[model samples]
Target: MGVAAPAASATPTDVAPDAVAAPPGDNLALTPPMGFNNWNSTHCRPEFNEEMVRGIADLFVESGLKDAGYEYVNLDDCWALPERDENGKLVPDPERFPSGLDALGDYIHSKGLKFGIYTSAGTKTCNPAGFPGALGHEVSDAQQFADWGVDYLKYDNCNNQGVDAVERYTAMRDALAATGRDIVYSICEWGQNQPWTWAQDVGHLWRTTGDITDTWDSVMSIFKRNVELAEYAGPGHWNDPDMLEVGNGGMTDTEYRSHFSLWAMMAAPLLIGSDLRVASEETFDILGNTEVIAVDQDPLGRQGTVVSSENGAWVLSKEMADGSRAVALFNESDTAQHVGTTAEAVGLPAADAYEMRDLWEHESYQTAGTISATVPAHGIEVFRVSPDGDWAQYPSAVEVGASAVQSEAGTTAELTTAVTNLGRTPAKSVSVDVAGPEGWTIEAGSATTSPALATDAALTTDWTVEIPPGTPGGSYDLTVTADYRSPRHQPRQDSLTVEAQVLVPPGEGTSYVSDLAFVREANGQGPVERDTNVGSVAAGDGTPITIEGTVFDKGLGTHAPSTVEIYTAGRCDVFSAQVGIDDAAGAGGGPPQRGSVTFEVWADGTRVAATGVLNGTAPAQPLTADVSGASFVELVVTDGGNGKNSDHADWADATVSCTA
Candidate 1:
């Protein structure tokens, strides 16, 4: 759900006629709201129903997440009828929300949790989940939400009919307050309207970017975009970089830990966007890390800042209430990197000998001098600093990532994890243990061994992890843990765990993939605040791809199915496709040039060829690139930063062939 915030210009309206003004000091979100949002998980799919909401709420109560500050359970888009009732009030989609929204709110409240609903500030909400927006009916909808006991409102900015963002959001703010309901207003305008510049008092949190996918690039892109805008984030008024993708399986445990740690340090809200019902244990741990939550929910409300950056490595620091500090060392490279910096570099007094506690590893140390750690590639190490000597909490100091050679079902695969000591001191008697699927036989490096792990030293742990010959192929998380003693710090023993995603492919051999094949999950257009496009698109009716209002220019380019993957395993791999603008991808849904775009073909993430800006004025053009010896080919379309107003583009007759 890497969608930008929705923003547009529109007229305003007054408050509800009969309702009283909200009570004073009704600013509900004293801190960033921690909760669950459905849009990221189910979206407008038929499965996004009341049962899902109730089950999530129940899990929140049962999973000890509520105790960890995850309170609000929000319904992002959908959940409402296409139009308002005769009384000019919003109605829940009875088919999906059988008990209605009011009953849903009551059920959530019964679990001692707050309930939130979604709406847009424009005349029309996001499509497919269509419903009249609050532009002309703000007062009425606000009153209805209050009547339903709604505690929060995620007000979006889709189909604004060209409304000024500040004015529209202000009107909705006044309307919500007039309903006499203390609703936490969340402004989602895709950061396009620069809500941070004007939304101080209008809303609690504002989106700062487009939708976020569960890819390393998405998380890293968001971190880069939102981290620099720390000046605008504080207690109630926060800069949102979209929802949580941790535990979603797209990223590794190390990456997820880094994602969660970084977001918390930025003082962003902790709204989870994963399927709670089937959330794995790893997901629960990441979501329920109250220690990290404390940093984000610190009463000071000051967002963390990047005090130092070098060679793709950075130190993000935040000041806490008790004069303590939180710091994270991030490594964004492909190899492990050691970033050495002092506590003072992260905004701490050089005179104080601060005790550092690793938030993720759950270990403590007393470091009087320089603080340093050898971080894993695309991983992070977080710590809380205090002016106290506390080494008793030191348990284990190990960071690990696993890779498997030959992960096919019938073949015996060798799974290896490199365990690195991130501690201030050396670790003795280092031993690696692995536990995998129930039926699989996993051979370890040793039952007991002594590997002295000096600070920053790496120990390779090999396991002949064999998958049952007939075991169905799928992704499996093999848990890898390191056990050792603190011969340098403490006498007590310690253990640390990491979950490695082992994927078993369908089959091996040369295979043909369609250039028309698509792989992206969500539409380039966001839901609720943008065009209502299908999650999956087809070149239907032997015409252009017309699922939803989105129209692919060439009958050959279908962006909905998935981003085409031109796999190349030989010496003569060629990828070719026709590029054009999607007639409906413009701001006004214009044809051709109105939705100007440049299509770039990436070979294994490196740009190979790009078409010049294409629009209605230009005829369809063909693009071809040699993907020889490349494992993956990707097609990316950009609006050249001109905005995807009507940028409905198409890549027709896409073909990937390896002649060798």
Candidate 2:
């Protein structure tokens, strides 16, 4: 039978009529709150203890997060006991928090950080353990929270018992005011009641979507929902799209960078939702980008609006307090795309030239009017554009990009680099130079120099690079440098680096793909495994490849949203594999029977084979693809419609047939 929907709530007229009259005048969250929340990475796990909480505060101070404007260190559910005390007051779990909540709050405050706590507006919290919530006991619970020195309150919606959202949320707002403490109020109703329409006068921030999962599809879905509500967000009030999942193990660093950039562009709350205790250096770099954070915390408090979206390319622009515009060129497709927009298009006034600063690269270039970039698949390029007249001092904005080349060992490949002038001024004596590794031949094609290049014009230069014989099958980097003179006759130079892959086909017969080295790989959870099932939680910690009780001696194991590119050198004719969710995914003590993924094979950037979404219970399915004359074959797996929880996928008996 189908599940029932939430019943309509009965309006409570007598509850906090003054609460809905106007928003709290405390001026909290003038910008979206920036901090960390311990729910996405830990859930209700045993590691969510007092010691871990204190460690997070320490990391915030030592890791420069505190200096970067991250203030609150909050706790989610499972911190309270199953029931209230004799006086009907919520109590902290003694075993988990022996020193109690007030002491912990003091420790966080000692570090110059604020303390935030969570409780539901319903009778019970969201977890299956069913902790006490603040339904009719709002007055006492708010007072207890105030006495505990809480600076922020994340009031959730679970077991709401058919009470109106406005009434339940308003009751807490009034009760919090009664405590006379300046507590920031966050409403977590999951947008079921369209909170943005009326939440401006009720709370500091309101969630506009359900919980976010750590996956690419989940990020895109939430962005699509929240990006449309720009009008409702401003100073002291924000439309939340749930916590961030940047450092979680469900997406690549590129995808995580896009996630962070998009959230900053949307001006959403920057509450981190990862375990900072074990976060990697790359994670810290992404979260510590001050330029991006400055855009989110801009006092002007204008949410970015979409200027255009077509063919998986999106352009969003936000006006800053200093009369600058933050433009984001986002690519949602599966391949690299060139996305561009004009300064006038992003609401900037007409000017002779503008300074476009690449937020990710931390470089500034002068552009006549265009703001553009060759965005990678599922990536973003953010630029802060402002009117300027320093064209003579700076070189013309030149964009350089190159196409990947596929060639076998001892073979010659052609690589083309396109240099475009994006500024209002002209470039003179433009010349291109190509460089490669030692013992490798690099020669430029005909017409490597131009006397003069006009604005908005492009100069394409091709170079033939030879791969040394016996070179291993992998990716190699080639650097291209473009030299020119600015309008003021000053010497200028811009350089770009690109990758080229050398394909190593198998011998005259069919061979197992596990024996070959991949040219590129990206996994969701951990590193891709060869001849074994995906690891339990770390690299090289997996068992033999097994799917539905069938063991494969020669195959590969990996997580969803993974891609493993094997070099075929256009000599391979066919590729075959038996693909399915690894049986270990369901057997582990982790969330059982929750594994779901899709398997696909792509030859030379074109999909050749696919299997619809498969769960843990499905048997192994045979897949074959005709990869004739294809230089590379990519084995890809994506999470099912649901979030990525236990998506351990296997490619059993994976083999490729090639000719000598």
**Could you tell me the lDDT of residue 547 within candidate 2?**
80
How many clashing pairs per prediction, in order? Answer: 40, 0
Best model number under TM-score: 2
* Candidate 1 lDDT for residue 118: 86
203-284 per-residue lDDT for model 1 (tens digits)? 8888888777776666777789899888777667889988898876667788898899999999998899999899999999
**All candidates: TM-score:** 0.68, 0.84
Clashes in candidate 1: how many? 40
Poorly placed runs, candidate 1 (over 4 Å): 1-27, 247-254, 309-311, 334-336, 351-353, 368-370, 389-660
> All candidates' lDDT scores?
0.70, 0.86
Model 1 CA lDDT for position 137? 87
Q: Write the per-residue lDDT of candidate 2 for residues 1-660, one digit (tens) a residue.
A: 001225328432432323444555788899999999999899989999899999999999999999999999999999999988898989999888999999999999999999999998888888877898799999999999999999999989888889888889989999999999999999998877888777777899999887887867678878999999887888888989899998988888988999998999999999989999999999999999999999999998989999999999999999999999999999987556778999999999998899888898887778899888777778898999999556456667777767777788899999887778888788788888888778789887867888888889888888888999988777777787889887765688877666677877777779899899787777766678999988754678889988878889989999887899898877899999999988788833434566999999999999999999888888899999999999889999988878666788999999999998
lDDT top scorer: 2
